[model samples]
Target: MSKLKVAVIGCGSIAKHRHLPEYAQNKQVEIVAVCDIVEERVNEFATKYDAIAYTSYEELLANQDIDIVSVCTPNYLHASISVAALKAGKHVLCEKPMATSKEEAEEMIREAEAAGKKLMIAHNQRFVPAHQKARELIEKGELGKLYSFRSAFGHGGPERWSVDGKDSWFFRKEEAFIGAMGDLGVHKTDLLRYILGEEFVEVGAFVETSSKKNADVDDSAVCVLKTENGIIGTLAASWSYVAKEDNSTIIYGEKATLRLLDDPINSLVIQYIDGAVVKYELGGIQTNDIGGQSSSQVIDKFVHAIIQNEESPVSGSEGLKSLQVVLSALESNETKRIVTI
Candidate 1:
């Protein structure tokens, strides 16, 4: 079969690090177009990839040969761009925190359904080797009856991470929607749901803008979740961490406790009730960028979905499940009561 022709919209950090590089690596894909509001970024990416560059996404979407589109723009643009791509008959892989609100996410889903195209959200953590292994174990009943789990994701801030740091859209509520909760918390929320194979039923949360600098959005957030299976746990995320720690979950089950940390590499520690401790040192999963390994995995999966005619690892509906957790957390924080998820 011929290679799938793909186009990328929004030549931002994620496009540079994850989607572009991964698509370039995939023998089944040929990136035929790149777009960004910033002409310079689009030009550089298109030049590097040997693809056509456009300043407007509309121009790129007009390419009838493009089989897939990756929307790497900010949180707010996800729905509009994805809907357009789907309507244009191209599969879409959108970045996580799928939309600023549930309504937008629903619209994107509807568009994809109407267009008979795939719409995936980039919740790449689902593809990490350690996380994947843990999920398999849990599904196979290796963890026995699950009890609870805790997870967190945070960094110094997005200033250094983004091309525009403090001035980045991540620091602006209008662009980012919800700060730490949507940025870091949503990933953990999705990870927990994926690993535990349970839906969150309720949430109690505390969101605060503790740091005075860049006070437009939340700096930190902590939430308690109760799963449908009655498993309960805590999730914490922050841009306030002085140093970086990609600390993740500790799932307690009847048979054992499972732990995951992604800093050095993806590592899993499983402790059984009989005092047998098993540690699995799964190295970094292949990603588009080193720091964004999960993003790379997400792109690879999306490409594979296109090639194999299968469902994406993180479909739009699955993305909504994670987003619902974040939304519930926001409501919980505001109302000072447990919010149904």
Candidate 2:
């Protein structure tokens, strides 16, 4: 079979670091085109990847040879671009916080179904090695009777990560739709859901813009979440950790407690109530720090799904479910009440 043709929209930091590199590494894929609002950036990526360059996504989607589209644009454009790509008979791999609202997310899923194309959300956290192991252990009853947990994803800020640096859309509320919660929090929410095998049913939050200077969006947010299985936990998303990054989750259970990405050396550690300790140096989680780029395994799964005509590991509906938690947190912050999912 001929290699699947792929086009990437938004040649921003995500495309630069994650989608582009991974897609290029996939032998089943051919990078056929790249699109961005910035002519220079698109051309640069096209030259680097040996693909066609276009400034308009509509124009790029018109290329019938392109079988896949990676929507790595700002959070606001995710729904529209994915819907258009699906309508154009192309599979879509969209970045996190798939849509700004419930209606938009539903529309994307509906269009993907109607088009008979795959729509996968790029929630890379689920693909982390330690996270996968944790899920396996939880499923095997290693952590019996979970009591509570805490998961946090934080760093200095997105400015250093975005291609545009300080002028990036990450700090702009109009373009981003949200700040820390949508950018960082949504990933943890998805990871927790995948690890625990449950849906978040209720949430109360204190989302605020505490640290980033001159930013209209929330820079820090802490939410209390309750899962359908009666598991209660704290989820924090922040861009204000100026000193260092913290991408860790601690799960307290009746038998043992699982500490993930907590220690610098051991990515996962399990301590039993009966004085037993287990450690696994399964590598660290992905971070914004230089040389922290690890294979997310998202693009590989997406390519395989399309080739085998199978459902995406992280489908649009799943993305919507994760997105609902963040949306509820935002609502909870506004209403100061526990919002029900």
Quote each prediction's TM-score: 0.95, 0.99
State the displacement of the C-alpha of residue 40, model 2, in Å, after optimal TM-score superposition: 0.8
Pairs of colliding residues, candidate 1: 159-165, 288-296
How many steric overlaps are in each model, in order?
A: 2, 0
Model 2 per-residue lDDT tens digits across residues 94-199: 9999999999999999999999999999999898899999999999999998889999999999988998888889999889999999999999999999999989
Name the top TM-score candidate. Answer: 2
> What clash pairs does model 2 have?
none
For model 2, the run of ten residues with the poorest summed lDDT: 285-294
Native-referenced Cα lDDT, model 2: 0.94
**Decoy 2 TM-score against native:** 0.99
> What is the C-alpha lDDT profile of model 1 across 134-221, one tens digit per residue?
9999999998999988887776767757777677998888888889899889988998999888899999999998863875889899
Position 3, candidate 2: lDDT: 100
RMSD of each: 2.0, 0.8
RMSD of 1: 2.0
